[model samples]
Target: MSYASIGKRLLGLAAIGLLTAGLSGPAFAQKTIKIGNVEPLSGPSASVGVQGKQAREMAVEEINKNGGIKSLGGAKLELVYADSKSDPTVGVTETERLINTEKVQLMTGCWNSAVTYPATQVAERYGVPFVVPVAVRDTITERGFKYVFRIAAKDSWWVRDQFRFLKDMQDETGVKLKTMALVFENGDWGTGFAEKWRALAKKDGYELVLDEPYPSTASDLTPVVTKLKAANPDIVMLVSNAADAILITNTMAEMKVKPKVTVASGGGHADPKFLENAGKNALYLFDEVEWNTDVNKPGAKETNAAFKAKYGYDLTGESVDAYVAMYVIADALERAASTDPEKVRAALAATKLSTGPAMICSYDSIEFDESGQNKNAGIVIVQVADVNGQLDRVTVWPKNARRAGYTPVFPANK
Candidate 1:
């Protein structure tokens, strides 16, 4: 009851409170960094989105196992998955939820360009760092949003490289491709790519015989193929997702509508499910893709093997892009050394990943430019080749990027 004794008791309580607060401060600072992954987990584009989710998860696991963001006191990455359901509206809603409700600092994995376009808008409004893994519509990066970064080649790049591949084919094998037909789904991705390709085809002196756009979820593509057959183009270029890609190929076979050359502008063509659905029909189908397993990039084989072991399927271009995006985010987080969105955004702007997991894609390196586009990223053309009764994707374009000992079977040969 003495005044001195009461004062001593108060001092002891204050010292204990300070000690407890000090101990919890570092524990709070070591909290996991929440990374949002928005994908179409259940819809027409579910396959692509699911693969992205898997790859993102694998990357997060690997980063955590390897000490995570070491600069952040070894803070582990916590991935929050939100299904866009392959719908643009739903994608925006989910992205907003991830940023506002889930409170994720960074986000990646919008497989469909349609989904990515709107989802990124939400991210920009909230000032969150949105890293696009697979979406390639040029406008995604052209928007001038500082928080948005795309690691894949844009639509314009893919179209230009596709024309370059055609010219290479003509020069190498003397296979003249004069006219081309374009068929694509009527969505942001398909329509945007088709329009770019049309311009590029004209620029390259190729006549656009048939330009057709169909619904993305169309059940049949017979009429489209019939139109393409009537046009009788020397080359048939398709901009479709996985389901539409298979449907068009099957319809073409059924109607006996064949072209001298068949090329796909990536999208669904680069998906593993495309091969599974098209089977031998996919042979000689050249596609301009962001990444291919055949490329002789360092760690590609190891990454593919690990992917197959975990997912029970070959790693598709989207999967690889998403996986690399995860590393890019991890790299940014490490450099930022904080989970603050602004710091992460700044770190992303200063990214210069060249030799490591971040360089697993076909790109020589990863570096974001003024518009948040990876300037070093490039596209490669790959042809589906039939080898010993089995189908294999063979890189055929950009001689330096092509896989050795792999020859493309021209349409004439097919």
Candidate 2:
């Protein structure tokens, strides 16, 4: 070979080597932010957990499609899900595994307060940024943990909204609520709601005729319903999960235990499955919900339409809350511009989302307080309404958020 040909060959080989390194450098440097998502996927709370997972998946998909955290060079979010089996201890164990074994930097969820309460402790101990979606126990954010954040309305908000709705009913319809009976599941979620309601009831000058707490796993609620029937209070306020909600509604209908007002402080009461299981029996039942599909909130209708089109069912409060949680985390990640847990925590604390898809909640905005609770978080009252021969969830209280021309048929006239 000629000297000129040999020099050209050498130059070509060097260029090829440099090009290979350039092509491989960015690919090797790219990072994926792993977020741990813990929920009860196989136990009593499986339905809610499943919906939450779907919401998270949808949010992550959307974020990725929109270029996946623009500040981080398009680093995609990788979700690591662990099933709590609807057990608190299991939730804690799964969370630990996700952090230690899976090496996830941030974490979200365990739908039930029982699971979230303990699971969040695990996240706190690990210094992982934990964002709670649907768990409403006030104590979840009261633990003085810097890494934990709750973006959903707490138990006190729900109970207070229930009273506000009661007052509205009396003022607008001349329905005097003299006495109330409290029946709740014996768990962190239920107990927190019951305690808040008790305090609010006293302050609001409402008489409490009966206070009952039952096991969440009980197969039948007849005993509790029997006691409630005997009390025959003017209003029966129940805090229960989906299964128990169905059982209570069925027992009440069968025994003809009718009250002037039957209210449920969210939890299972607001779940779409409750209506599916209770059918017409669910009519006239009032519920205090963090997010309702029928509410007049910005981006709610479009979001619900997309959710229904994708999932083939109406979006519930639990699902939407989880969806919002994902957005909050993505927002924080984008602001932090780094995967460092502490930086993400700080960014989350500084988050202020108002009037956008991220503000899909009932609240006007998303801003966490010192206690890691969303200060702007609020609840609205919704009632099962029959519209065009179909039972629909309709916002009926807080005149500002209520659907126009929709009147709640109290006492259901069944």
Candidate 3:
């Protein structure tokens, strides 16, 4: 046979095998659920996607080991993922593939807000019950789509809180940060963050000395760093994901243009690479994030420890968010007691969630109010400091010594 024919034959055999396993007997029929994942498995945010993918699969394994979703009579989870390539247009197409071709009952993911916005549109078109774990664009939930649900806090929630905390620092520490400089990538996520910061800085009585938005593909940010240095602001805040975050930090240090502190608003710096990339300069670089398993307590403590033991490294906002997202998806499936999309929608809409590191979680139950946004969830800010050259999250709010407040999580600060 020709090589093409042989390849086709192998593909046919694999399909047959999958079908046989799925159908084999009535027992299997009673317990099978397909989940579709849309994440940036390639491109600038690929590292974030890979981490999320690992955590999600691990969550499914744990759930299945415990007999899957009991409400669905031990319905096993089958996950299907596609790379969004970090492109919004591609996201829409991937969503169609998962829904039309894969025929998934429930869907989750698309980490970047830009990708999430367009992909969720696809979910609503097909009437699929979509649960978003990590996307944080304000507009994602603002559209009022009934079938879409966000279990994570929007970017607005976190950025707004960070501004409030900055004001708080000025009041408490007597650090009158007069001139402020802003540096961010020119993308949907970066644009959203820059506009919010601009408005808030002016409103809060800080001089917006400089604002520069770079393209995501900028070969080097030295020119941007030079502009920021000449402007000489009290603080410089950066907003970008993964590789870009490290690149900016490295340039800032190389140019010897360290502000009082460089605050970054993304989980990008929460990874080990931040320290590994910038060495000593990584210290005092602030970051605002969703959840930290290091602060895990009670149930979360055990879960985080188990995760570290299993994964051979620590977890980040991406990993933690994906892990919990998996459980929430399972919970929704269990509550629905059926894989029918309509029933799953009802279950997800009626969900009330409580998870590890309860302090960082939402007190309110899972319910999309109008815009399909999480009723609970909030963002947390961190100052990365090296303790003997290892990066760690240093608390900046409630004095870093105090950890109680009226702030929210799940859909935090709102």
Candidate 4:
């Protein structure tokens, strides 16, 4: 069936779920629960932020159409948006405005880790529940804030898995990788990943050929790529945003800097536009992500098809997390049965969601720990390849999760 039809079918199933849940009263339309969303709507990170926004809109539409909040007489969720412009100061102000002015009952977003770090602080201070979907900076959940909950794997986990994938691939291919390079955008997210990469590289006994961090907004990444070429490490690890991701990939290709292995941490690298713009340049690059279109989950393909039908692009890891965050919020609200902040916070803390649309994630379940981190959160590695003449991401690590019939090119340079 076509993706559009599949999306329609999913909506039909959601309606069935609503009926099963005993949703019946038209009075539910009388109340609308406001969810504050702070995002980088028009800045360097805007592309990713907009992707998150679209994903949330899709989830919210499904929920409202099906039943709204059944326990609250089916009250629909209304998203209130504030553009952070990828600025921390703007994030802080927008978050406060959403709470005090817009009067949102709960909150989400500010995809940039730097913005999310402080914006979540504002949510915690005001006692509003903030459900983070994609910001991976470990510190976001480590601050002991009761109101902040993260749905994605932390940067530490991401880094850990990156190294694991590298090791597993080496073992399987009999390729001995010795030297490594770390190149990332100089941001909270990138810096955080770099810190972990440094320790892991040392622990694994790999030589550090080069370590460089560049501005995400830099117009020219040729200098960094030049350094990378000179260092010529066996493996090159990167952390970049959308625009810079394209620039770096193209620049590396242009400069003929082909490392034995090129790995990306999935910010801009996972963006659909990254694939479109980077094209063949991104071929054979490995990226760590929470979800992929080819993931083994049941509903993943249909959901991605629907999202692509609507948005004209496949869902990225960032968008998938944002999509799941809405369901998490809905589940909490369903249990809480009220917009009361404390009750919602409590319900969120007790989340053990294992079914429904949210299960479309690569992981089997969603549950938070004491730190408000999703303890069940996991990551997967995918390589860019040509499937049926289309450049696409194919899951290629962890043995079982690897896409069938496709052998990965470990060292594409040779």
On lDDT, the leading prediction is 4
Clashing pairs in 4: none
Please write out the lDDT profile of model 3 over residues 45-146, one tens digit for every residue: 887887888888888988888898898768789889999988899988989999999888878888888889888988998999888888887888788787
User: Candidate 2 versus the native: TM-score?
Assistant: 0.91
Q: Of 2 and 3, which scores higher on TM-score? A: 2
Ranking by lDDT: 4, 2, 1, 3
In the range 306-355, model 4's lDDT, one tens digit per residue, is: 99999999998889999999999999999999889999999999999999
TM-score of model 1 (CA atoms)? 0.91
Q: At residue 84, what lDDT does model 2 achieve? A: 89
Candidate 3 yields a Cα-based lDDT of 0.75
Candidate 2 CA-lDDT value: 0.86
Tell me how candidate 1 scores on lDDT. 0.86
lDDT of 1 by residue, 310-402 (tens): 888888777888888989999999999888889999999999998777677876778999999989887788889887788988888888777
| True-structure RMSD, every candidate | 8.7, 9.1, 4.9, 9.4
